[model samples]
Target: MTATRVCALSELEQDSAIRVEVEGVAMAVVLDSAGEVHAIGDVCTHGDISLAEGFVDGDTLECWAHGSAFSLRTGQPLNLPAYEPVPVFAVTIDGDDVLIDPAVKKAV
Candidate 1:
């Protein structure tokens, strides 16, 4: 799997999500409230909206369009309107850079 550098760790705010593209795959990189970083599919399974534009609550990300909340670590939807789980990617922190492997999705 090819590891692509998405962003710098300093570029991410605490408890916020950022939109990124790795090899044409849209992804949402989140820095949860607990100061942990996670990478998941950017699109909301319930709608066509981007998850990075949603709200970050702890380890969960709430989609702004349909109000579907998803677990950052597992990519499982925590609410209705979204039954399918999003893909979760593997993340690596190399010094100040945040690297993501779009080809290496974490198994549910």
Candidate 2:
């Protein structure tokens, strides 16, 4: 499958995350503090809470419901209550557009 255009790069604020869905897969598109874009599964592995609503600190996204921080680059859970790693998708930036492929899980 080809990468789907999620949103414009300009639409994302630095150090923030946006919720998007690609091919029925919920995703959290994050712009880290260093201005790098990352795509991870939106749902927390420990619960049904949305990771998009979590806090972005450096390269990790902290789940708001259980304070479980997941690495934005690898989707590995960094704290308790979540022992499993979330899926990290491939993210590509083309011009001003942000593209993501839910079918492709990025290598950790």
User: Each model's TM-score, in the order given?
Assistant: 0.96, 0.98
User: How far off is model 2, as Cα RMSD?
Assistant: 0.6
Error of 2 at 58 (Å): 0.0
Model 1 agreement with the true structure over 1-108: per-residue lDDT tens digits: 689999999999998999999999999999987878899999999889999999999999999988999999999999998999999998999999999999998766
Question: Best-fitting candidate, measured by TM-score?
Answer: 2
Query: TM-score of model 2 relative to the true fold?
Result: 0.98
Worst 10 residues of 1 by lDDT: 99-108
Q: Write the per-residue lDDT of candidate 2 for residues 16-70, one digit (tens) a residue.
A: 8999999899999999999999999999999999999999999999999889999
After superposition on all C-alphas, the RMSD of every candidate to the true structure, in Å, is 0.9, 0.6
Clashes of each: 0, 0
Which ten contiguous residues of candidate 2 have the minimum total lDDT? 99-108
Q: Residue pairs in steric clash, candidate 2?
A: none
Alpha-carbon runs more than 4 Å astray in model 1:
none
